[model samples]
Target: MFVQTSPGQSGSAHVVVLGNEKGGSGKSTVAMHVAVALLQAGQRVATIDLDCRQQSFTRYINNRSAWARRTGLHLELPVHRCTEPGETMQILDNESSELGQFLNAVSAVERAFDFIVIDTPGSDTYLMRLAHAMADTLVTPINDSFLDFDVLGTVDPMTYSVTGESHYAKMLRDARRKRRQLDGASTDWIVVRNRISALESRNKQLVAEGLNELSLRLGFRSIDGFAEREVYREFYPRGLTALDDLDEALGTGPGAEHVTAQEEVTSLLRQLKLPIDERGRRRAANRAEWFNQVNKPLDVHDILGAPQTGFQAGDRPGPRS
Candidate 1:
């Protein structure tokens, strides 16, 4: 039995872990977007990159900070931390060291932030399992092809039906079970079909069917993720997300593709159903109210504070001499 020594159950932050055993599944991209989206929504969000070697998540955040500095745009950034890989020769010693680092990082921000977005490496590791066990919401982004789906389950060649659970799926089951025993909390696992093609095809239908079947058995929700979009690739260099103000970031009007991409991202966030603070909900409500009143005539009391002195509603102040 893998005992959790650290105070993993005491934190208040909802930990969101992005886990996919296979590479090129868009885990880092999804993690980045989730963190930024939460931050934009008036939530205190922090990010942890457990992939010490690849560090794609870390680099993406660094790129965002650098772009913000160069362009002088106020880009929302998370309190980010990257765990250092162990250097010792002994496997157990290295595991202990790495575990300590991971726990320390979580403990530091778990109470302070509203959400902690963790990007795990492609391959399974001790740290990866640890992160999964601690996740409040686990997001697994798999490419649309069966090659990517193999990580979750094997499909029958004759009928293209899901046959059995895969290694990654089995690992998740164990982690979730352990988590339940430790804290009596269930991890909300979501499988996302990422980089999906725009056109419908026979293969696409088969994959969806397979996902639906597997999700029923595993108790996971499957959702359509970001479509294959060139705009996503363009956003990488500048550390931008579909949720960001594209017009200001790109210095031009956003196109139809950008709009669609933004819609996809927004839809995904809604499907995740992550918890939002009361303040966040109020802020969103206020924002919608403001937009609803954008075209309405402003009242003098609302605009000029009850007509202060000579100021009236819609009054334009004279330029200073």
Candidate 2:
């Protein structure tokens, strides 16, 4: 409902793409959370789900819409769309169909919204590559496990040092090269470690070290993202994220995990350095105060009964010319 027409020079929305080669890496979760956070922060945001086969982000938005209608909150929601290619047998035709549809989607919403959060499929497809090139910010969420680390870099088992770039990392390099050549814009890529264990492990340390070295080498920022908490999944049915009003929706103030979820998101947003309005800033302050007043030691059982949120790891940035 708050969608506005605010096309800058190029008449395009600042595209934020959630990308990862491996499934279950939390791309859809991050996209939804960031989009919702921006909406709450008074930004005219839109969303596009290019994961045509799965449509994970699209489904999540639909859930949010249905929940809002049921509750009569009139919560601000972004205009969202899902784009998939035509069922053309020929490779050329399929590619063309996808390119045309993606371009049409961008044209329809770019000038009308401030941000376009795109959730890409796990595989390397034409649409995925195209979206990557258009991105102003590309957020890649990976788990703490080395299996997930395989998607980014090959870490030496002995020294725990990065041996070489992995396949997905190479793909990103190509995307960045193409992006720079086309628009003279550097895609601000940030790698976030998602679903980290509650307790530290030696493997987690090694993965962090690998990511640190890779961040230096590949020109991306890395940081700690969301924790492995059941509360995240509990919010699914309501289509509510940590950014939403918990007391009204859930019949109670945020619990400890909920509070932590809020902090994780707030910190993540600040780290992204996205453009935020004055009202957004004010709401952020109020949210902090409200959470502080309700912040208390929570039992695990109670925390489980409550909820919600995802990505944006406000970490120390390292990219510079």
Candidate 3:
């Protein structure tokens, strides 16, 4: 059972789990950013990638390992683990086996790390549910579209009314109830709207209004997340996060795009209100300054040693190389 921290108390690592049931919602990307942000803050961070099939989060870390080794850069890498569920003749056996594996994974890092960031697959699974129930902070990243909004709540097309709670919302409520019953730990659910369009449109406004209304009923805080940027994707192959010391590692100063990306990460991390080194400080007075402390401009595209074939920048997506 997880214990909640109180005045003059210490306990397990805070688990921030990123999840959503729909694909292309950028769950893995958000998980990577959050993990890296915590790491850059001089905190001990561990990560778990439950998406065994894609393994995107694990792959990102692997890429990071390669980059750090090649450049001899002192980059902060999380103690990472990936779980592979085994097949069994009986369904109950499979569930039990997977649960044991998940618990073992948690036990391995719970005492060692300050924070554990988990990336769940874009579908409802046994492991996903287990991870969700364990989340101290449940971050649900969604695109700024009604299609994406439907995963949490159903909306009326004619009146733009949120008619009822979706399955995912109900699932979270049940998880919260179970958590309270188990050990009185509460999960903070934050709905982050990512990949927002630069151009303001009626659809965006409608989505915002619908989310606001849903927030009232669902009890989740909403925040603006990363805008659709090619910069986020370009660094994937090299395992470079906006929070990295790209200026020093790449032998060039940071560029405008790099600053923008790091600023977004800093702002997001500040919003998360994560626990760091301070004793009972809760949060830094000006955490945003961490990124701004070093601001320089070199062409991000030009510095990327990997093939820049997939993207050309300016918030556009190209065919995966």
Candidate 4:
């Protein structure tokens, strides 16, 4: 829900859509952590889980609620599940009435969130297009593997020539054209290189070179998303925030959750050019370590208690033409 701003709090209405046409791309994980980080930064954040089919963010929120209940950890994050008109359909014409209806639904909810983070489905869909149309900034996460980078373009085996035309590129070009046509939206598309290796590997360098070339030719800026680690896996059973693992226990504990969180947060800060002193880093690490050492996996129901009473997903009136 939206928060009425007071004199002291900062309000920057930024809508971020986490999207990629590839599956298993860590879109949900990045969305949840970014939402958590934004909350910690003292902004009123509202999450829109648009992936109704998988409900990944919804599940994470449920687990977060459970963990909060069992451990007395208070997370003031509000996540809303939004369903567009034609999400089930495989194809949608930009000029169709259904497309306009979906766009209006997103615009209506814009008033409720200080920062709206939209989590989109893995592949191309009507919902994904709607989100792109509404996005102020688009964050795309990519892994350090050649197979994963194939979505961007295919590299020739012998000569290493990169093909320009690909499914992902065409979709992006179409989205850009749509933004130009609408004339009110400008999308800042950020590419996050995910699953990065700590040590320098031959393959890593090749992928880096390929991405660099692609960025120069295509005009998309690059940033390090998250380094390759096991912490991502640990958050599965019970979702944990980036700072949630800042304590020492999380990083060194059985799950390696804390370490993973630390790497991800540090990488993001560096990418954004934000400063994080040593003391602040150490404190978070200790807390994570302690939590992992003393605690057990808590049920989501235990953390969050119960479903939010009287919350329903109903259609709002269409936007004015």
Candidate 5:
């Protein structure tokens, strides 16, 4: 556990919300590991479980707590379960006052955490929309399948050989509109194609091309994201492979799994550009001191109030000439 910082100066309150209407898309799993990865890089991270129905992220955190007790890893991160208003057992509306309360609490926390990762429910509810509204970076994880592609964008080349629209494009437009009216914050939308295969397939190529084309046209960026692998699923059981022993960091072949778990985490950090550096000969703490500094978003106050000077005949106050 790390020390918390005072409010208004949260050392790491950057919020990254993971959202996708489709379930079983590794939303919770990705959220859990991403938070842990940040923690491994020595960041004081916190989580918000917007999926009030299942509270999957909360469950994962509980499992982690149990593991900590048994292994003495002492891993702990604050997981806030949102309480829906009206005392009814229904999905909370993100647009409701209750959702605002959650965001308010996030902002009002006196102690500063390094990162805030939100795990949204697996549906297109008002809460999901609210998560999108609050996200600085919205990560959409989808499996590498045609069904998932449809969620990201349109595929009817024949219907509109001219004007092609996609689900992802519409989502981006909606998010942009909300930002203008409410948050006034820019979003970095990343479409993650999860559960990809190692082998090269024509179908895979088509999906990749579609994603690339859509990203180029719609102003979204796509990374390798996560590939299909057992390690991710295994996390549900052991609460993710520990950072002390990672042999499959390189590969899972005969000698490919020689890398340590720490190395695997470092690899992930490098991939996400989260600022984790390799250790030197000495096993000095490889924790990053400027983790938050690297990914800091422009302060709206600074941007809006920045002074821009245009020289004019009497632009500056001076004695009458």
Candidate 6:
């Protein structure tokens, strides 16, 4: 059996798992973002992609490494491992192989990294359930619609209220219970409403209400996530994140949408309430202070009189073709 060690109990890495039973819920995207955020905060991070078939999370990390190499930009990357499924025809053998690889990966990084971010598959599987049960923090991202909300709870048609917990929610309850029984550790579950609409609508209101009601029963905190933005899609190609130094990476000043997206990501990270130590807090504070000052228009005296050392303020290059 895998060891059930609570995070911060004996300096073990805290486990954060991104999980959802249904597809197209932005699970990999959130996983990548969270991993990068932790790394940027000056915390050691390792990532495990449990979706051996799809491997979307694995590909994203590869793309980031490639983009960083091509552009010669410093992109922080976590120690990553992608588990492979068994090649055997027997179901039991396949499960055993997958479990061995997963356990090995966890053991290798458990005490080395400050955090371990796991990206689970869209569908239920043995590995997914195992990851969920070990998670110190579980983040579930769902689209802002009834179709996606149904994965967590069923809502009444007439009243638009939460009727009962759905299959995935029930599974989570069981996983959390098992985790407690194993190690007396509590999992902080957060449900993120992703791709939220900019304008208010009746559907949005109803979904919000239903989620609020469900949160009361499930004991999971609900928070807003990324809005429907094209920039998020564009970032995939370059493996860039909202927290990155966009002007230097993109070779142009970031637009208002980019700034807003960055703010959203920062807000979400804060809401996660991860156990960021003093060093991480200082690094994050320093980075925030730099970003705050970097955008202000520079005066002539400030630019002309300054020694030309390395990258200077107000000297960012124009947009790349």
Q: Pick the candidate with the highest TM-score.
A: 6
TM-score, structure 5 vs. true: 0.69
Task: Score residue 48 of candidate 1 by CA lDDT.
Answer: 91
3 or 4: which has the higher lDDT?
Answer: 3
Cα deviation of 19, candidate 5, in Å: 1.0
- TM-score attained by model 1: 0.84
Q: What is candidate 4's CA lDDT for residue 195?
A: 83
Candidate 2 vs candidate 5, lDDT winner = 2
Off by over 4 Å in 1: 1-11, 281-321
* C-alpha positional error of residue 320 in candidate 3 after TM-score superposition, expressed in Å: 45
Q: Counting only residues 3 or more apart in sequence or on different chains, how many pairs clash (N, Cα, C under 3 Å) in candidate 6?
A: 0
Per-model TM-score versus the true fold:
0.84, 0.82, 0.82, 0.72, 0.69, 0.85
Candidate 3: list runs displaced more than 4 Å: 1-9, 87-92, 279-321
Each prediction's number of clashing residue pairs = 0, 1, 2, 24, 12, 0
Index of the highest-lDDT prediction: 6
Off-target runs (Cα >4 Å) in candidate 5 are 1-12, 76-101, 157-163, 180-184, 241-268, 274-321
lDDT of 6: 0.82
Q: How accurate is candidate 4 locally (lDDT)?
A: 0.62
lDDT for residue 302 in candidate 4, whole number 0-100: 20
Candidate 1, 178-214: lDDT as tens digits: 9999989999999999989889899899999999999
What TM-score number comes out for model 3? 0.82
lDDT of 5 by residue, 1-321 (tens): 222222222243567788887788878877887776655544445677777678778788777657556664434344344545435465454346567756665764314444678898877766678778777667788898877877767775643211355554577678767876884656777777777787999778878888887787676667655665555555565464434233332233322332333344344434444322222101113212222345432221111111222211222221111
Residue 137 C-alpha lDDT in model 4: 64
Winner by lDDT between candidate 4 and candidate 1? 1
Q: TM-score for model 6?
A: 0.85
TM-score attained by model 2: 0.82
Clashing pairs in 2: 268-312
Q: Model 6: clashing residue pairs?
A: none
lDDT of each: 0.81, 0.75, 0.76, 0.62, 0.58, 0.82
